[model samples]
Target: MPLDTEFSVTVMGLGYIGLPTAAVIARTGAMVTGVDVTPAVVETINSGRVHIEEVDLDGLVSGVVARGNLKASLTVAAADVFVIAVPTPFTDAHQPDITFVLDAARAVARVLKTGDTVILESTSPVGTTEKVRDLIAELRPDLTMPGRNRPGEQADIAIAYCPERVLPGRILVELIDNDRVIGGITPRCARKALAFYRRFVRGACVTTTARAAEMTKLTENAFRDVNIAFANELSLVADTLGVDVWEVIRLANRHPRVNILSPGPGVGGHCIAVDPWFLVAADPANTPLIRTAREVNDGKTDHVIARATAMVEAQPPGQPVACLGLAFKANIDDFRESPALKVAQALAERFGPRIHIVEPYATTLPPAIAATGAVLTDIDTALETCAAMVVLVDHDIFRSVPLDERRGKTVLDTRGLWPDQA
Candidate 1:
């Protein structure tokens, strides 16, 4: 039976995942109340604008706000559906620190009512949904579980874990287009969740037990973490052996069966680098592959820093160096845990006033980044006068940069963005 009622949904957290999810639910004609701990985020979403960058998110949010289907608040209220999309970062020793999830869950529990369905949409460790169920049960002992069509005797709250797997840049398309994994504490719980998502989801709905679904999400990221580590490790070997890793991968991938991952400065952003440790923290002895992969990817930051430092040391006396790109990857302005940004910081620390940074996407240098004495300059000015230009990010703007005039200047291409002469 499809639950066709107008769902009054409250989405907790307003970052990358939550805001989009809230907007999409509102697009389905359901009334959505988005809650964020940060007051600024609440204000931003309420204004029909977004603080984060995503394709069409601004328009989607604006439309929802204009339609009066979506609103933002600082705390949760009673609702039919509650989605917890908070952060689950790892601790210093690489253990899963789900404090945010726990706090959000407790807050949601405060407003839970009869027949309410609580979905844990944050990427979490296995058994997290069940743990949430237990927490709710402990908090509200009078409510009964939805079983045997009984709906229990008291106020009932159904709990499920539906992991979101969508690309940050293409969240809107993937939200409806990508198949979803829905797992609940009970079969009734699972069915109810599937029915709720079917309203907007164009892709398949994979039903499973809650723990399996949680592990499924963690496994997806672990898979990426491991493959990226293989590529990063290969980069170290290729550098030592004086081989072009990109060329080797290009040839190797020609077999069709062999697919080598691209090596970069380091893994960045929230997903790939952070999710694997959740598994490692849960069962330390059993996840050697996942743990090592995290170490490899995390260590790559230092390797990139060392390479740039060597360039700084080897530069001609008093010749200014230009750093191209600060973001982790090309075409995006996100600098969270960016290896290129770290490299620039390290270079400025070692070279002092000699380093000039060029990040075309960044309108202004962040305070933490600006203190390093890396002046943000335009692309032309950087390429024309700088003695050494180290290409850290493969931004397309740097592709058209005239290296002919830079024949005598040092060009250390860490990104391998330029073509080689025959």
Candidate 2:
């Protein structure tokens, strides 16, 4: 059954995923308290505004705040449900770091009540949710905790793992429309968590063990990473043979069984670029393909940087090179694990003031790029002045530039933005 309107929810980490999630849940008439350690984020959401960019999120947050269905805070508050949606960034050595997830769980445990449902929405390695269950068991021994050992037994507080599968621009719709995989430490725990999601989600909510859900999330991303690696590797091979990769893909994809993903500078976003590593790290000996795919995708960035460098170096010494877009993908402001940013930053570090960056979404240059003397200019200035251009991201604004206007400029289009120019 769907949860009642009177049931409350508290979301930890009011970031890209968390904020949208909080606003979406709030729209369902459930009172929501969004928690974040960042003061700016809390203040922004409380002011009926959004800290991050997403389609229609500003109005939704503003409406929910105005309607008194949502509020923001720095500390965790007592609620019928707690959703941990924090980051699970990997370490420098590519190990899965669940520090944020565990921290959020700790905060929830402090204020946890007998009937509260704790759901972890963070994309994590397998066994992360169980760690949350074990941590809660250790912290609050007074309350009974569910586990495989206690199988099917009722627990004071229900705990589950529920990872979101959302595209950047369509998070709000997907958050509700996407089928959810709700995995619990126990079967009863999964049922308890399902009621909360059932209130808003229009799609089916499948139930399973917590470990399976975690692996499912990782598998989904890893599968994409592997496929993207194939596309990226094909792009490299096509370049070696002086063949048009886009043309090759277009012809190949005409076959009924063939469906090749578009190749980019590299794999990116918080999920595809990071989650696959979790699976690889979990068991290195058994994951040769997954590990190599990660390596290939990462290497594609280095390859991009090299080719872009050559393009810039070919220009006259005094002439600047315009490096377009910084976001991981087109039309989005998110730069998390973005290969485009890596390429831009590398090129800027090499040529310094000779690199002019055009990112319509970014107001200020990333510190690394700006510190190296790369100037942030509009597309007009870049087109007018720079003799060489490297298209890192295929943003709509960049794609609209006509072939006639860029006639005299030397172009290296990584994203296949302007086919005529290519």
Candidate 3:
């Protein structure tokens, strides 16, 4: 299908995934309106400035906004297509919560027309897309809906699930080039969404049932969580045997058939750390491996906290201990489910003002850490003043520090970033 420049797209939740998707769709000449609840976010994007950080996203959003193709608003309006990209975060019991998804669906329902297509791009549990279809049907009984009506019959509107499959740092490129799985309540619904995505995506858009699409995303993240757990378990075993985990992994990976992932303090981010639990929660009896992986990953954070605190306790009384990097992974400011932040918080709670944090991405310490009297400082200041150091995140700046500069400092390198202790 050729690009439809006249199509109007309204994307809910203009955060990590939504903003980028809206910007890229606008780049294809579609008039895109990004819907976000935050007033600051709405004002920032309308002025061609971004509130969040993503590579090349600011330029893309600015370009699209300047061309009058993209805008941000606090309310949903009439559009040809509606994309719900809100956060489907879990509840206190780790059960998959679809409150945000349903809220977006209700908002979309208010302005839904006969020919509009609604796509759920948020990562959700199985059957969420069908739930969306049901919600819309209840909101607007005049128009027929797909999946609820006869199989061969076409409905007034199309609804589908198309989960995002992109890394945080490379979302802009992946949004255009990555293959997407478009699954709908019915075959016709799938075709309609495929047509919309084909307008901007260079990669293949495969069609399937809505249930399969939701499960596919969960499987992808669960697979990663399981593999990372193996590496993290190995790191624990290596420490017990007095062997360097990084060196062991390097030698073990020399075998052509064997490929092992590097272990960190723990698996973080919204996906790997949280998605596996959805599987376990859905089928507690059958998902033993998934449950174990989640436990191991969660345990790794506790292990890091124990080790870092032990090092801090061994130091002289009142000596500051530097905790480096609070972001979930390297080179990103996202701290969702970050093990580094947990470890830093534990250290601050244990030693009060003696915990010095060096997160290059954050301008100020989080209020909780700040309330504990932790000081957020630069890498040089941390190295010069702190008696002990814990490398929680392997950021580029932390890796570039010379080995000699770390001499005479009590260091617990959880990432194994500084293998050579000079």
Which lDDT tens digits does candidate 2 get at residues 332-355? 899999999999999888889999
User: What TM-scores do the predictions have?
Assistant: 0.92, 0.98, 0.98
Off by over 4 Å in 3: 1-5
lDDT of 3: 0.92
* Candidate 1 lDDT by residue in tens digits, 212-263: 8998999998999899999999988999999988898888999979998888
Superposed Cα deviation of residue 86, candidate 3 (Å): 0.6
Colliding pairs, model 2: none
Residues forming the 10-long window of minimal summed lDDT in candidate 2: 146-155
The residue-by-residue lDDT of candidate 3 on 173-219, one tens digit each, is 99999999999888889999999998889999999999999999999
lDDT of 1 at 345: 80
C-alpha local distance difference test of each model: 0.83, 0.92, 0.92
For model 3, the run of ten residues with the poorest summed lDDT: 1-10
